[model samples]
Target: SLVKTGTGELTLSGDNTYSGGTTISDGTLIAASVNALGSGDIDNSGVLKVGEGELKNTLFGSGSLVKTGTGVLTLSGDNTYSGGTTISDGTL
Candidate 1:
């Protein structure tokens, strides 16, 4: 499992394959690639930023998702996150 905390930004850019899931308790987690978050469940209690790619993870939490940067950030999965999503600067 991956747990992101603190008050900074974390960027995920690799085509990850971890199935243990992800948990964001604070700060921001930027998905910089299509498969950056891998295929797992996401529990975000902070900020989830999608820069320019596609995310296919199942999200569920009480945080917020912000779309930033240029290009398109496509959400192409069964996302169950009970958080607010905002388009800050770019296309979501």
Candidate 2:
């Protein structure tokens, strides 16, 4: 379980088994793996990007997910996130 609350960059490149929610208060959370989000809600008001793999996790809160980087991101699964999805500059 982890929470990003600083002016830094976080990249998820492996299968995360954390049940805690991912909160990006003032930084970047990158989803580089399919199971990066884990089992929890997402409260992101800063920045989030899907570099690769599928964000196959149920999302929560009112934050937008922006896809970026140099690969295809497949967002699948029973997503219950309240924010929404946006392709600022990439494929979803």
Candidate 3:
């Protein structure tokens, strides 16, 4: 199951499961860090902004994954991209 908390923070604890596609629109997800714990495939279609954390596993983005602050974007597996990525004004 998927769980969401208040606007202060959102956390998905424990081993989560998904049979179909999961979509998260305009929002912020703050865990101890951002961990994509799965051996399956992750198809990112929207804008995903990672704050301060590590992004484990493959991240397939159709849109973009913007990172602000002193955060790190970590990919443990393979990442497939169908769209383009741009870094402007020292921003990524």
lDDT of each: 0.83, 0.70, 0.44
Model 2 lDDT tens row, 1-71: 57888888888877778887777877778877556777666667667777666666655555567777666
Ranking by TM-score: 1, 2, 3
Q: Which candidate number maximizes lDDT? A: 1
Tens digits of lDDT, candidate 3, 20-51 = 33333324343333543323444555444444
In terms of lDDT, which candidate is stronger, 2 or 3? 2
The worst-scoring run of ten residues by lDDT in candidate 2 lies at 54-63
lDDT of 1 by residue, 3-73 (tens): 99999998887777877889999999988765677767889999988777767777889989888787788
TM-score of each: 0.82, 0.67, 0.47
Q: Model 3, which residues run further than 4 Å from truth?
A: 1-32, 36-40, 84-92
